[model samples]
Target: MKQVNVFLCLTVTFQMKWLINHGKNSWGIHSMSKNLDIMVKHLTRVEGHGNIVVNMKDGVLEKAQLDIVEAPRYFEAMLKGRSFHEAAIITSRICGICSLGHQMTSLKATEDALGLEISTQTELLRKLLIHGATIQSNILHIYFLVAPDLLGAPSVFPLIPTHKDVILRALRMKRMANDIGDIVSGRAVHPITPVPGGFTQIPSVGELKEIRRQLVEDGIPDMMETVKTLASVAHMIPNFTRETEYISLKHPDEYALYDGDIFSSDTGPAPDSDYLKMTNEFVVTHSTSKHCKHSRSSYMVGALARWNNNYKQLCENALKAADSLGLKPNCNNPYMNTIAQAVEVQHCIENAISIIDTLLDRGLKDEKPNQEPTRYGKGVGSNEVPRGILYHEYEYDRKGNIIAANCIIPTGQNLGNIDDDMKKLVPEIVDRPKEEITLHLEMLVRAYDPCISCSVHFLDVTFVE
Candidate 1:
């Protein structure tokens, strides 16, 4: 057996040098040779609990999978028999990080079921809220979660001494993003102002102007620095590629974060109502979260998917940022999902400024929510959340109470894709040292930024004789 070479670098700068010199070659052509069994009990730096399990015997690959260890949360069951007004508020509690996304998607579903038509101002405000949520979530993942891996540290805490400026910059950017959420949606975590139809209270012109000014003076500049920082360490990312189907929401006018029709890389556009066909979710014994497949054995839905489908709609500066970050259109590499998210942070900053300008020009309105139901029936709502395309479906009665509800989380849709990537990835790196192979697997899992807790809401029970 050939002993895999390992480099020990202490500082961020030396780590980059090591990555440039040896990292790429480590992942070069190699044949599987060793018999191994690996299990990561609980992966770190992600939202929820999950384990990576792999077993190999006599050079024959046996099993490679991501075990979703988190227990079911029963969010769907909790939604049954709830009123339309309480739907968004209750579902928003599903994820603290993605609460705004859930709230928006839930409102869209509720509004669709109850026939509530929002005004132009309401739509603009919601879009701004989404932009803020995206900015916040992306920044959190890039800096707090994935940066430690690229920088050769166990966690972000160790990088404080060497990368003080970088840490400070991350904090500043996150704070600004949170401020946008606080001002627009009421609070950063679970938004309070937004409802089924419109906001309980509109933001003042002065508040919008201040946010616009800060984004211009600080947010854009910070994003530019973020790109440079990531570019310096981009070589640390693995150079693995596997072409698969990419799925996301696509709109003709914008980047498709707030609203759009369902789009697939393998196939063309489909109405949002056909999400069930696109996401054929099934039971997987290893996971409480149901796995999804569409057009193939598996597909991906998230930042990279949106980039592949909607790169043309990105702002000019965001396109330039993508080029600088090595995130090209039609990218097959899953590791570049982090880079795609960085590009989105840039776009969200610029787009947020534009949205604020539009809102200020139109002036703020203290209009009450339109709760009148023209017709009560079934409705579906879809939005491109920070992780991926999140769908919510509800059936309501004439009295505005929910009879049934279904939610398809993005992480759940990407589980099968993650497992498939592992099967291909493990063999390529099986010859390397145990530690190195383990790190690669962890990085691959983190690349998708899976929200395991969010995905475990669904569970299938069987009663056998």
Candidate 2:
């Protein structure tokens, strides 16, 4: 067994390739179709640590599981007893990739607890920020992480040589998205301006106009090229499909990524307060993270879910991108998640422009955020984050201090669905070569874009006699 690791300075990316040769009769065994115990100590290309284990004995499947070994982050414990004003700042540390999502959701829950209201300008700015983060995250996942698999390469580093232009295009789009976040929230990665009720500092009309210009000139053109790039490799994606429930926030006027009612394909729309009933999380022994279910054994969330529930609400350009890419509503293939994300990137870019136009027309306001808390109570804030529907629930005391905090991340909710998918996928490909089986499984998980770091929070281990 040999391993090679490559680091690309251009993209700040690292990828690993394994070279294993189990020579015939090396271990007194000659048949490749014998009993097997395949254990992947660590998976690659994802945000954090996880393992995939599949077992089979003489052609009979035994076990297939995604084992998450990351330690619990205990972010909820850190929130307890903290002031309402600091919730967003503290929760932002949960994930660097989705820091803006955490901050916005935290602020919404905190503001609701104190009965605070924000201005129209603030809401418009927040919507732009969400779009920016969505674009940034989706581009990173599709090009840097998943594209290599489709191109039959071990990592994106190899693609850089053959597909240099595609790599550059991806970087350009990512930079523009990050700039949008920086302009609105004061920084891209863990935003600084947005607070409980509003932004501490808002962009000027001039800045808004400039961003709109960029979105119109550069963002849209690049998205068209991106759609073409992905469509060229659409055939590389597996055609497997499994009908399951899709959940996301849905709004009547527009595709909901910022705020809306919880809508499930299995059921209809429900209030955000009923998130607990929607996300019925339970423990699984193979993983440290909890798996969630709603209206079935498992359900999916994220860009694909959003598309399934709110496809009609997408902007004209986004709808066109979907049609061109052959990505449609109720797309049951998990592998199409990457395609959905790409479609969303285009949608978010157009929506950001519309939001900026609205802000410019309304004119910038210098009003400070609402800091006064009329009363303390329980509040739940739900938003369609990059990964999926994220819920932040808080119970505040009279003095505006947190009594309890519960955050249900999108990745945590998708673990069960991934497990179920794996159980079905392994059987279909069990007769093939081991390397092929492993690659397919990896592709399936990457399609979900699982953030192991964000998935592992507090967990209670129980024993049964």
Candidate 3:
């Protein structure tokens, strides 16, 4: 075996190609190397419970797979017989990192079933609360979970030694966002402000006035500083890019975070009702996440894809800031996912400010709850999550109980893409020592910035010689 002349794993925004992938929790191997063919009973990288099997027959790479091993939970399948309202709150337990995304998805599904429409003031409040929720989640991902790699630290905990103040600021920012979410969401970790008719409770004028000012004036600026901090570090890597079709929920009026029609570069636009016509899912035996193919091929969704798809809709300041960082439309680099997060933090801040101004000036509009749909109807609810595009499909009863529920989370959507990436990335480093392979894999996960456990968990690798 010939070793590469030089190899360096630099965390600080290493070279990223256009190809961004998601987190995978498992692996499988089928070798035609005439050496060994072992079926992986389970695949994952969590707790280091998996290993890549490489077969070489006279200098030819025959078979390779990095596997994950973790217990799988069927969350969607378990929602049967649950009332729409009950299921809405219960499903929030799916991912600690994906609270607000699931909440709105669940709310929309239930509201559609119930035929309910809320007041304009309520709508504004809903958007504000969700944005606040995203602010918290994004900050957590950018600073607590993601910044360590860009700074070459092992994890957020270790950064305390030298980056204490930065981490503290990030934490406070995250905490403030979560605190706003908690006030509306009931507890922040799993919110319940939304319901079939409207909110379980509404915020007082004093409360709205106070939180709005803080988020726009105080929290937003802090978020910008964090964005600048991350963007300053995004150019270190130049080799992590790969080309893939970017897919997202597109809204013509604004950046599509809360709700919009499903769209892709390949498929122009599909009504929410027609989403099933395009998205297809096949369960992978090796992994819990249902590997998805857009029109039968893997595609991407989430922060980066959303940013790219709706780059034109960005608020002026955010658009200028992203342009300043050299983030163009249709960015294919996975490492730039961090940059997308930075841009969104700014956009969310701007969006929040403008929303407050609109409401404060025009005053809040009032409307009644939607009349319940008597017939069983099906509709899909989709929006950009802090992680990516989240989809919820429901079959409802006349009484507004969820007779059937289906969710295609961002993590599941990225499974096929992640596996494809490993297949391509591993050969580039298979000859390296075991430690080198491990480092590369870790960086791969970090690059995705995935809420993998949003639907599933991380990979567990166990290498077999």
- Identify the leading candidate in terms of TM-score: 1
Candidate 3 TM-score versus the reference: 0.82
TM-scores, one per candidate: 0.90, 0.88, 0.82
**For residues 98-165, what per-residue lDDT tens digits would candidate 2 score against the true structure?**
88998899988988888999899888889999999999999998888788878877667878879999
lDDT top scorer: 1
What tens-digit string does per-residue lDDT give for candidate 3 at 1-465?
Answer: 111100000001011122212223121132222232222212232442444444433323455443444444445556666777686677676665676677788777766665566567667767877777777777777786667656766667778878887888888788777767766556777776666566767655566577677776677678667757766876653345567766788877878888778888776777777655655766554433346677535777767788778888877777877876777788886656667777787788778767767667766444344545545566567767776777777777666666677776776566556556655665455455655555565556555655533111232334454
- lDDT scores of the candidates, listed in order: 0.79, 0.77, 0.62
What is the lDDT, from 0 to 100, of the residue 454 in candidate 1? 22
lDDT of 3 at 274: 67
Task: Report residue 131 deviation for candidate 3 (angstroms).
Answer: 1.4
Cα displacement (Å) at residue 345, model 2: 0.9
Candidate 1 colliding pairs: none
